[model samples]
Target: MENTKKKRYVLVSKTVLVERELWTRVRVAAAIEGETISGLVEKALCQYLERQAEKYGP
Candidate 1:
């Protein structure tokens, strides 16, 4: 059977300042988890949004 799944792509660019200590912690966690910093940040943001949505609805 032919593949039915569709590829997805999302592109975003932004610049934000973070405390040095927090940045260091995120970098270390990403390295230990074998994930890119961007991925880690995106995962965190998604989870945060989910929590907010649960509390506020949609």
Candidate 2:
């Protein structure tokens, strides 16, 4: 029987570009944190949403 815990997420892919220095910084930070660039970007976007919500609460 297959172990359910062995299943993996099939990540959907996308691409975006940044200035060279920022790209370098992101790559270094991702590597240091053992996270993919996508993971870092996703977390950044969630944080951005939180800040916006705080600024414009309903």
Candidate 3:
């Protein structure tokens, strides 16, 4: 049998302030997409970081 190890990540809570209009839009989009605001934000952030890393250095 082969052994495998799973990678673990730690998630931490964070507070972010956004404009009222943008926040409302995000809320509506999240509901329509069936995704949480936190999840949407996390995905966007990760994509942004990946682009930046590719452009610059990881």
1-58 per-residue lDDT for model 2 (tens digits): 8767643333234445455667778889999999998899899999999999999994
Residue 52 lDDT, candidate 3, scale 0-100? 98
Candidate-wise lDDT, in order: 0.80, 0.76, 0.75
Model 1 agreement with the true structure over 1-58: per-residue lDDT tens digits? 9999754433334557665666778889999989999999889999999999999997
What is the Cα-based lDDT of residue 30 in candidate 3? 85
lDDT tens per residue, model 3, 1-58: 7668554433334555565667778779889889998898788799999999999996
- For candidate 3, the lDDT comes to 0.75
Q: Could you estimate the TM-score for every candidate?
A: 0.72, 0.68, 0.65
- The CA lDDT at 54 in model 1 is 98
TM-score of 3: 0.65
Return whichever of 2 and 3 wins on lDDT. Answer: 2
Alpha-carbon runs more than 4 Å astray in model 2:
1-15
